[model samples]
Target: MKVEIWSDVMCPFCYIGKHNFEKALENLPFKNEVEVEWKSFQLDPTLNPSETKTTVEYFKEKKGIPEAQASQMVSQVAQMGQMAEIDFNFEKALITNTFPAHRLIHLAKKHNLSSEVEEALFEAHFIDGENVGSIDLLVSIAEKLGIDKEEAQKVLNSDTFDQEVNQDIADAQNNGITGVPFFVLNGKYAVSGAQPVETFVNALQQTYNETVSPFKDLSDGGTSCDADGCSI
Candidate 1:
């Protein structure tokens, strides 16, 4: 079974979903047979490098919420992260444009270090409060991961893997994805949001047990309305 996830580094739910999915896989019987792919999705594409706002400030401005409410909300998210064994230092967390980080992730995928890079980016952003959008920080992290520092620096300094990251974003858009932590199972079934571990395990089991039938028409053939239009 192959599972692809579209998520952003700054997305708290993505980290939570990652943890839940890992727990689910750990308990699955065919965990060794499953392959996972992490796709890129940017929550804020127009973010500028000069923006020095904290996550709390960004949320307050974006959602039009008061600073106090935003702080409380972040605190709640921090507590939830703690429960999942993720240390989220919202106090020092900086709001950054994740496009560069996504590009590095694509490059890491080519070297079979995508998972390591993803985890490192998440930890840098949420736990260590490091600016993952910075090339210097990314190169440092890549070096720490045993990847050739000069090669990684060269990739970051140039436009390498930028197209791949853009393609991933385009693919996510084509799939009608509007949020992070979206999971696609076997390129057929999709589940959105940070669901519980049991839910993910059940979905994994269902996908594993079902056989792909080329001649069978398994489509639900339902119609739905959205902001774009109504479609079947």
Candidate 2:
């Protein structure tokens, strides 16, 4: 089975969903047969790359909500994060454009380091309060994943994977996806948002079992044995 996840680096729930989905995969017997791909999405595509503001402030301004409401929203998300055992420091999160980060993720995909950088990017943005839009930060994350620094820098410095990043976003739109942490299984089954681990495991198991057909019975009643008795 193949799973494609649409996520934004700065999306708090994406981090939680990623961990939950991975935990689900770990419970499957055919986990090794599953292919995981990280697709890009931008939560705030129009935000300036150099903009500096706390997540709460940005949320208040963007959503036109009051300060108290915005703080409450962040608190609720933080509570959800705690349920997933994720440490989210949204108080210091900066609202910056994630285009560069998404482009770098595409670049990392070439080296099979996309997943590694995705986790690192989320950690930097949500927990460590690092500006994810920084090319330097992204390149450093890629380097830590064993990706070539020059290649990563080159990609970040130029529009190398811009098209790829846009393509992922376009694909998400084509799939009617309007949110992050969206999971598509084998291009067929879809699970949205930060669903629980058991939900993901059930989806994975069902999709795996569906590889074979379970046709409806069409003939006269067939004889079958049950735990209670045998049909004759």
Candidate 3:
């Protein structure tokens, strides 16, 4: 079975959803048969890297929420992160564009290191509070995942994965996906948001059970009609 996840690195729920999904996968009997692919989705493509605001400040300004309320909102998210054992440092999070980070993910997919790269990027942005838009930072993250430094640097330096990243976004749009942490199983079932582990497990189990490996013969071929003759 193949699972495609549409997510953004800056999304807090995406990070939590990953953990939940992994836990569900661990409980699956056929876990080894599952293939997961992370697709790119940018929460804010128009964001400027030069902006120095943290996530809290960005929410305050953009959403017109009070500073305290913004902080409270982040605190609520932190509580959610705690449930998944994720330490979210939203106070220090850099509110920058994630297009470059998404590009790195696409590059990692070619090397079969997409999962590692996605985890590192999520940890960098949500936990370590690093600027994910920085090419230097993305290259360093890729290198840490055992990817060739030169290859990662070259891809980052140029717009090599730009089209692929955009295509992922376009595909998500075409699929009618309006949010992050969207999980599609076998292109037939979709589970959206940071659902509980049981939800994921049920989806997985349901998909597995509903799958018919071989067609069942309902009746014997006692009589059949052909172009030549009909058997009675």
Best by lDDT: 3
Worst 10 residues of 3 by lDDT: 208-217
Residue 161 lDDT in model 2?
85
**C-alpha displacement of 72 in model 1, angstroms?**
1.5
**Residue 44, candidate 2: C-alpha displacement in angstroms:** 1.6
In order, the Cα lDDT scores of the candidates are 0.87, 0.89, 0.90
Best candidate, TM-score: 2
Candidate 1 regions with alpha-carbon error over 4 angstroms: 211-232
Question: Model 1: clashing residue pairs?
Answer: none
TM-score of 3: 0.90
After superposition, candidate 2 runs with Cα above 4 Å error: 212-232
Cα lDDT tens digits, model 3, 113-212, are 9888989998898878889989899999988888889998999888998899999999999999989999999899999999999999999887776563
Q: In model 2, which residue pairs have backbone atoms overlapping below 3 Å?
A: none
Measured on C-alpha atoms, candidate 1 has an lDDT of 0.87
